[model samples]
Target: MELSPSAHVDTFCRDRLPPFDLWPQLHFDLPELRYPERLNCAAALLDDAVARWGADRPCLLTPTDSWTYGDLLRRANQVARVLTEDFAVRPGNRVLLRGPNNPWLVAAWFGVMKAGCVAVTTMPLLRAVELAQLCEISLPAVAVCDHRYLEELQVADAPDMRIVAYGGGAPDDLAARCAAKEATFQNVDTAADDVALIGFTSGTTGRPKATLHFHRDVLANADTFSRHVLKPRPDDVFTGTPPLAFTFGLGGLVVFPLHAGAASLLLEQATPDQLADHVADHGVTVLFTAPTAYRAIMAAGKADRLAKLRRCASAGEALPAQVWEDFRTATGLRIIDGIGATEMLHVFISAADDDIRPGSTGRPVPGYRARVVDEAGEPVPDGEPGLLAVTGPTGCRYLDDPRQETYVKEGWNITGDTYVRDADGYFWYVARSDDMIVSSGYNIAGPEVEKALVVHPHVEDCAVVGVPDERRGMIVKAYVVLKPGLTGGVTTVKELQDHVKRTIAPYKYPRAIEFVADLPRTSNGKLQRAELRSRAVGAAG
Candidate 1:
């Protein structure tokens, strides 16, 4: 399909998408999955809300202000006008959006889509060198940034890129320029399969991988997971900690709530205590955050404040059984744990309420299919650990990268996760396939050891990785963050070792344990095992 109509523009993302055959099998059998051939997701998500629901409906809320659907729609329209008329952005142009999770960021996201420009949203915490790597990959023509972040983007060394900053009162700022624009705009008519966003995965080594998603891919996620699994209502208030740059946040905090005609609170910073306080004060019904955040809320003694929440979604990392049980014991709400990847737009495997199995990542969402497979891409029998493979409407489409072959093989997206499916079809997460540690002829999932250790009273957070050992080839090493006022001495180390031995197989216990104030994590809150491995190597050397 011809997605872009403008003649004078760059088609970088579209040109770089992996061949069709390399894409995982896409299914859209559900009635709600039907989408028009030509679509602008922004119009469907924003403009349609004003038409279907009333303009007076609450859409976005911040600590200081709340915006109705009409307000967001008009602002997004003004942004589109500013981009096309003032910045010379045309259809098929690439625009980079930089900011934390806030109303302006959401407006800029819709503005890019309305103008038919592919949006590239980056984490606010990324340094210049990392930003330089992204610029080298997507080559965005224009960047809409929060004014405070302009210096870093400038230092990224993209000579040709034009930047427009907002969040400051400068006359040249995007908000200032947008003030003069009309509150109405004719959105570009983009095809369903048009590249809408390039989500960059925060990999530990080498350049980050840019995952391409079509305009349809965006709606598909909301329609599938949000519609079926979350089942959000119009009165539901959504909030989360994941940055919009992460597809997890995009789907959970933005797309899902909007699709349901619900209100969302955008926090520039949502620490665990703050998140819990917001839930109580705002009457938030649903929350989307990481497992760590959930654990923190319980640890900070703010779990009771979250009594107002009915549904709590966890992702970005595995939800340990201990954490899940502790949360349920405190809040009486079973946290919905799902496994999603940047390649697949959002959560495909998830279960809510009574369907939730504490430790297992639930069955696939209605529109998707999943399986555990061997190295040869063949199915592994139930109860056997294998690669997690999924096929659905949304799949991996790497931008100009040959790793496409490694991610999507024979119509299944290899998620790089080791999983074991029980007789009942619940998928139990083992670890990142690469994270499985082989020590002394024994296979141990690092996360399993971490899970056992995290249940200890003194442990706040921890990571387990295999370190090279002359006698055993490799030995399990754990880096732990202890609770406040708890010291990690020799006595504590032996106590944790004994605890792990008692919890699971004795051989799987950590042979070495180090104490740290915090564990390294990606901006999206996933543990950076690769960095932990490097730290272990450094300590051993």
Candidate 2:
């Protein structure tokens, strides 16, 4: 398919796209995977849902209100009208969206796509510094933000950008302006391969890299993982803890549900306790959350509240075997473990139901292909740990960045994760290629030790890292968060050490243990291992 001449106007994202030969091989082997050249994701996921299942079907639910498929379509149309008429948003203009997960926020996202504009959704909790960096990179012509987050957007360094605030009483508020606009809109005719969103990676290790996704990429995920792995039903109710800004949330909470004609329960802020409660109260059938959240829910003795769920998914970090086993024991549900990246849009490797293996991230999603390769990019033998390389319907396309070479090489997405494929083809995660620790003559994956420690009844949370040591060059160190009443004394440390020795290879046990009240984490609940390593080095010095 060729690019539509009328697809875009600004041309920044399109012009910056890495050359075609540099793109990872794209496959569309499945019959359902075929997409039309002229496509609009919002139209396919939202308006089409309304057409297929009536407008009155519930699509989005929250504590105080709900939006039917028809309601969301009307609101999205109004938002598109406001963008075109009030803000003068042109085709291909980048539109920055700032807000929590809400009906309005989802509507704004659809509005951007319907208008042929790029949606750069930023986390609601981000401060001016982060917002300024995004504004500098995407150069959005306008922003649709929640009233609560307007201060940060106003202070962000985007002099040419106009701001429209929603959920406020101000006369110029987006809702009020949208109210005066028509409830119907003609969506722009965009090419299937036209960039629709710029998803920025969560910069836990370094500066955030913006990943571009074509309109087809959005629907491709729903057709692949949501169809084959999740197999959600139209009556299913989905809920999760990830923010709308994260692609995981965007896929799990928005695209997957609407694609399947299911309803989603959106939450502005959800702790593990709150998430469990909502599952019980809303009769949520499908759950999407991180491993940390599952552990916290189990620790809080609230696992019983998730009895209503038929399926649970774990991602954003490696799902330790111990965590997976404990969750299944407590809830009788084997949490589906998947390995996905912001670069790839969603889970390219996952297993469902009887196919799930406790410690292994499953084979590639049907439309994708993956392999474990050595440093030279040659395929490694089974049982040998090496870099994970993947190619599929979706792959990394960084936005005008020099790091493009580092992400895409030789027609494959070189995910920085290290893995070893078993003789059966299940991929066992070793560690992040960069996070692998070499102590003495042994190579240790810190997550293996952390997993061994986390299963102990007294351990609430833990992180394992390599600490500098003159004699051994580097030694395993564990930073642990104990249960409230548990004392972080010598006895507890020895118990954890002994637990690791029994769980995996004895040589991988942490040589030193430090009890901390909490481990550093990103806003999305991913462990900041780099921060933990830095602190350990400082303490040693």
Candidate 3:
């Protein structure tokens, strides 16, 4: 597989891509997936949309501010100028973006793309140590952070990474620098296959891996899922709870909306109550969030505020069948449940409207194909559970990691989950085939949590597992063996929880902790996680 002539001046990312033979098969069967060899996605999504649609149309809508398509271009252009002039960033240089979801964060992303630099978006909830690990992997040359959350990033060890703060009145802030730059500039001519962004995802080992996505891959998702399934209208207003750092939110709030010339409302933080109010006040038609939030919104008795919503999407965790039936009964809207991975980018398997099955994650999107295969990759009989493998316009491509071989087997991306494909082609939910804990729409690794817990001085050993929760689909539970004569009680639990939170992202901290004499281990000295999961399930019940 010979490569195309790249537009990136710095070839670090292209040099690190897994050898051509190790790459997953990418099929561009859909007409929309066809793209020009020389293309920049930022220019395609933003510049082209403004030209096709009127410049005066609202593009990004906040609660108090509305940025027209033309306005967003000017801001994004300024940001691009600042990157090249102030920070000395070159094309293909990794620029780490840290911030909550907002108009500025969106602008920074576009600006990075326009300048031909790869954007590395990290979740705002990540603590200092987690951020440091990502920075070490990507080696970002510059970091753009929100002023409110600058402390943790400042403490993180980012090699040769200069920090620039946004959303501040300080004279040296990113906004202040942008004001001094020109309002217009020529965008970079990056190739369609050039790496545009790197999203970090958790592996079972607890260490994060950088997932590389090309400029065309960004639009491929919108073309396949958003075009065929979501079917967005130009007048639609989209809002969601997932942070922009996550690919789900990026597709829903930014890529999908911009691709369709629709308006998006960027909320930095919103509870179920506040989200309901925003929907009613702003006439939000397209909504995206997890099933837990949908349940919470109804429990808060804010169902009336969701009267304006027409389409809703649920992902991150599986949408329970009962919750789906209950929400549909109340709102007269059937939520679209999809299964997507960081590797695949966005919802490759989903159902919308009349095609949706309550208990099944619907058929593959128009462009993609899915299969349930045995250990040897042979197709399993219909209704029998096996590995869920997917391949289409987009698939996983890890940057310079040996795990690439594990993720991409043969020609398909083998998502580490077991599922059953019915005779009708509807894929039903079963269970995760790996040790990942999907709690509150976040994928947490048990090994990662165990590493954080075992570092505490009072802890002798620890095991983390996902336990069923009525509220959240699953909650991270930890069993710990204390050192010496400490009879662990509430005080011990609180101390250990705080320690784990400080060591890793707060969301990965074990919500439920129990004292144990020892963890179960097999004769080979490997931890028996299956036995513990059973014990945790019993204790949870």
Candidate 4:
């Protein structure tokens, strides 16, 4: 239970950290991974970057405006002031950010860190109930949300949480408040081990768990994965489709570029065509997104538009070898594929340049170690499918959740993904070992969709499984047992899909629905998920 004397006054996150013995073994073997005892990532990424790269270097970009390192620094400093002076937000308080990716949202994230508060950034697509669950978990003192997306947060009504909107023309808006503040506020001198942010990930059971990351953990991902693998240049322009709430987008679009003194084009919304247009028009050198998007752009004949990209990264879900080969054949640039989890922060395993293996999730990045293990946690031989265990500078640290034991076992972060390690040390992707369905880079739980479906009056029973899709990698497909009187047809399928969307995030809704008399079940009454998944794959094949 030895932790640094924490800088957080609230102590909520610090108090909730899993005991040290339960934590996975953390490594800082790389020169870059070694950090000082007292470090604030906001200052290290923003202020220090501004100092090293000069103030006028462009840092954040959108279709509408560009923010220089100086511009972002001044605005971030102002945001820190507004939080303290205007909203009475104290150091160590959690500041929930709800918005699409934009310059203002970026500013708010840095500002919260600089103020020594934990930043809990949520996906803008989340509904009121979803937002309320996050609010209950983190207990943020203030929520700096996008003005256009204020209704859900308001409906959430988190107790004692003040809501402030950004990007509004109102006199009391966040923009106006920032305009009144000075741009030279001091950053809080927090310990390297101080809790910086809490990213939420849905477990196999569909329950969202909060993963706590320290200030040092924030930079460790960039230092190891981004530095050694992506090798971003100072002039690179970053753009991606994953929301900042997803650790993937945060690293690709914000943290990695900032660490390299490059510019990130923050798009509030991007379709495959729109992303291609932006990459071409904005002179984007580096692109981060899912394999589904890459295939969509190619299918839509927009692949040629991405000729400007020098480096492309694919994650969020497994990148199919065919997608990798096709994109390369289209653009003459190989896509770097990797696997990262919210609990671990960013990419720990990836390959770049000549080391690229078409479909394999390349060897672990510098400062990390990975292996395949059996159900008993013993290492499995190469070429055998088993649970992927990894140890790195950052590992799973769930906040006050018993599932910490489930994720971290025998001192290794056991990523629920099943993988086969070749004799060459390359990890080949197998199906997910857990009940989580990753579709188009989104991790959705089958049980969550099942939960939403059973509540509908029309559905007597339902089982959701991840079925293969060429574009999305995997799509949620639900097999249903409808009430005796109702005929499940196109109309009923539409009804169930709409019902699930209303109940949870729209992405988790089942894309395909088939009416069945009953679902396969064990004699003991357990759902036979593996059987359904196998049948779905066979049928798809």
Which candidate has the highest TM-score of all?
A: 1
Model 1 lDDT-worst window of ten: 1-10
Off by over 4 Å in 1: 1-9
lDDT by candidate, in order shown? 0.90, 0.91, 0.88, 0.88
- Sequence-dependent TM-score of model 1: 0.98
Candidate 3 pairs with clashing backbones: none
TM-score of each: 0.98, 0.97, 0.83, 0.83
Residue pairs of candidate 2 with colliding backbone atoms: none
lDDT of 1: 0.90
lDDT of 4 by residue, 143-203 (tens): 9999999998899958789999988898998999999999998898899999999998743
For 202-303, candidate 2 gives per-residue lDDT tens digits of 844556788999999999999999999999999999999888888999999999999999999999998899899999999999999999999899988999
lDDT ranking from best to worst? 2, 1, 4, 3
Clashes of each: 0, 0, 0, 0
List RMSD in Å for every model shown: 1.5, 1.5, 10.2, 10.0
Report the lDDT of model 4 for residue 489. 88
